[model samples]
Target chain A: MEFNAIYVIVAREFKKFIRERSRLFSAIARPLLWLFIVGAGLSRLVPSDTGVSYTQFIFPGILGMTILFSSIFSSISIIWDKEFGFMKEILVAPVSRLSIVVGKALSGTIVSTIQAAIILALFPILGFNLSIVQIIAVILICAFTSFSISAFGIVLATFYESYESFSVIMNFIVMPMFFLSGAMYPVKLLPEILQICAKINPLTYGIDAMKHVIFKFETGPMSPDIPLIIDAAVIILTSIIFVLIAGKAFERKG
Target chain B: MSIIKVENLVKRFSDITAVNDVSFEVEEGTIFGFLGPNGAGKTTTINILCTLLAPTSGKAFIAGHDCIKESAEVRKAIGIVFQDTTLDKDLTARENLIFHAYLYNVAKDKMQQRVDDVLRFVDLYSRKDDLVKKFSGGMKRRLEVARGMIHWPRVLFLDEPTLGLDPQSRTNLWEFIAELPEKNKVTIFMTTHYMEEAEVCDRIAIIDNGKIIAMGTPEELKKAVGGDVIYIKTTDNASAKNEIERLFKFNVSEKENEIYMTCGMGDTCIPEIINTIGEKVISVRLQRPTLNDVFLKLTGKTIREETSSGNDIKDFVRAYRKRH
Candidate 1:
């Protein structure tokens, strides 16, 4: 990626986020709602397992949820770009179109990471302790997840004509990824079919990986390590593939 | 020398040939209008030449770079302001220009200065920090023009630059566009469905049905059919058309509810032409056949009346909304 272009794009996205406070509010609200209300209620309903409290177990899920909501919603700008004619200006620019796509994805990723971090910060308030390394790890994981998801969002933006259609697809694809990834409940507790589905879900790997580090009830020793690496790889790989797809899609006029 | 050359360029979307074997050359440092009826392939041709859409066949070159093979170079040399407002509504006008400047790889310090200059040029300096969504349609369009100038490109592609603006806004935009050639030496290649809009160009290529039927200086095109046009308004327009066609045996087109015909030797012919039609002609006016007639003479249709219904799906959205 061209660093200058990337910086500009990210800066633009950040400014846009700041200007559209309602949009930011909605993005921040959804995950924060999930973490507070849904996670709180569900934790009491399910039998506690594996020395992980409800908040700790659910922390990783929120990271995936954060990535999912923020990344997909970021494609809203693409629709706006097409509508407002800024896209034509961007498309006709002298720079590599790939840089434009990467720039868009990076912008989305950075914002998504910040939103994810905001949600993560709520953990200590809810009575879970995160090590400095754990906090750093989750940020990277969330950022990567956001990039991959936002890249895919851009790919969808090329094919979708309206935000209604985009939101429908996000509901169809991302909502399922969240539920199936064992975001609310551990995969071991799901039905056999859902469990199978969860294992394949990139979200599952992300959630499971984060679970290895989050400390709740101060009971668990240093957690599992290898799976987080594997999950990180999946996210990085997905980011690479979807970003390339987005770049090609942006190059297309129709 | 021609700064932009398009030869036998064709583009098809499934069954429709949006752009047929259209060919034209644009001289450097002159404003060349690409005129056509709606759906007349003006936008399609512009899109192809700007490297946004690939031509089905033939070729186009911008600033010596082939559009297809050297797309990036073409992109660098040409700036496009699309017919649709392409502003980032969330950003201020200045911010939007800066984004475009950075995309074109303008230096950071220079980006600020250029952003200010363009905003000033568009007369949006007062609203520079105002979000674009708050601006009027004309304001947004001017900002789009500013965005196009961010890179300081030599050739600018404007696809229907003044469409949908109020008459006052259109006039403002026209005056701004008219000054650009003299001010910046920018080779302006613009497409417009509006016949009157093309008249402002130094030269225009009137295209219809994916073909350029006429290409020349606006005056030359009008003079080719005749030195000027004779407008005869009558309640019996059909009869008047028949009588005129019978006498002159020339092509004609109508616009704005007025029937117009072109003829050579306008000074001498106007009196005879009016007398032949009888005095029932409520008013007789003679002026140059406009770019509109040039378009009509080439294709057997009026350029103003042919609005493109490119997709049924877009219609469905509106229809579905009404039903609900």
Candidate 2:
């Protein structure tokens, strides 16, 4: 059965992730730097009319940013595998292409969620008093968000075979997704066209779901842009669709 | 029995015909080599047989499984060591083998034994725990070979297995590869531009420009060249070429200031030529026909004339674009 193949691909990627200590450090460090540096500096200029401070306002978005970068870049290993010739080893095996795609998505999900959890753990220091239920809810949202985004990244990975091309395209998509995703500001504040773009972005709903769980604001300027159920549903549905697309991409290549 | 068969195989990349109307059969339990220069379609043929490529318009079978229709089965029956190193540099040597075993669906109970046995077969057991990144080029290659064999494939496809190794390492790696078919009863299908390396094969097909120009055993190929070769460098090669042809009635060719020709008895001809030739005799040497000579005799050009730089660019471009 290809279950063993999937297990081994995941195991191999996880082993590599662990061996690269710098990756772990940087994954965790990137989110915290934004929280302290950007969040602190922007908090004074952007006054919070709502009860929450600006730093507290953007906390969930910070977690979303963590997931966005980690989940998306995790599939960069595909480019690395191609460059280093390791992809040929896996491609020539008896395993189905679906198994390989599922394995990559799962590993990226796990790795990204771990980084998100570290950022979520800093909530207390950032002055948010969260109960255990909210923390679990946030972790669940991060996992779903990471899986969908990672699968999307895999779809992008299938288009190009070089690191330079992949990075150039990633920067084009990732930064705008972050800025317009209501991560730093509310979606309502964006220009109409960009707000449309933000609404279409999967990360927007992810961060909005985090807000729904953390703040529990049902209806306010500070409330989540989309309903909690809708956010969860969007993430789950996109994850399936993206995984199928990536799987088909691999199948067509062979 | 023939383990691999290709009939009228053709693979075209838009305008370039990489493997054009190729046909061959590889016998079971014997080393069969595809001898060709870079971009002559050696790797392209191997890729088609290994199920990594679908031929443009032909049928290929591996162990009775169709390469295109039954690719998964074909893949299961064959293992490939590509031209470049494919080992996971961050993983230990044993980890790489174990990963490969798992991918091939090796039984969990037998996984440990097979991994250990293959590592030992490659003589890498002592350094099984070392990361591949720490290994030298030769060690990484040995580890790759060990990984390729962990699943006990019926046919092992080695594409330029010794392409970039030092002489000692090349010989060392060949020792392990040369022992596989005899010791393990596995049919080995490999490709090499190295004429000496082609000599190890039980049978060879000389491919050039996407077509098999000649196919036979090494001895048969050498015998086809006919007679021994005598190369003479005189102070005046123009006169030497004319003098030798005129006196001995032999067909002589001049290349790089050296006049050479094929003669039935080079031992006797060398002295006769030296005594009769008018030009001053500078140096003389006689050699039995080698595979290089066989190649030269067929194509009128040495295989070494085509450098490997073109293949490097092909690899680079292949890495930059998705395979069609």
Pick the DockQ winner: 2
| Tens-digit lDDT track of model 1 for A18-95 | 777897788878877877788778778665656665766677888788888788778656876676456776776666
What TM-score would every model get versus the actual structure? 0.86, 0.91
How close is chain A of candidate 1 to the true chain A, as a TM-score? 0.88
User: What tens digits encode model 1's per-residue C-alpha lDDT throughout B118-232?
Assistant: 8899899999988887999899888888878778788988888888999999999999998887787788999888887877899888787788878899888877754566666
For each prediction, how big is the interface RMSD? 1.7, 0.9
TM-score of 2: 0.91
Model 1 regions lying over 4 Å from their true place? A49-51, A83-85, A216-226, A252-254, B229-285, B307-324
Model 2 docking tier (incorrect/acceptable/medium/high): medium
lDDT measured at residue B221 in model 1 versus the true structure, 0 to 100: 87
Q: Write one digit per residue (lDDT tens) for candidate 2, span B1-324.
A: 899999999999999999999999999999998998888999999998888888899999989999999999999999899999998889999899999999999999999999999888888899999989999889888888788788888999999999889999999888788889988879999999888778789999998889999999999898898877787888988887887788889999876577788887789888889888735888887877678767766766557666434354234223223222
Worst 10 residues of 2 chain B by lDDT: B315-324
Error of 1 at A47 (Å): 3.2
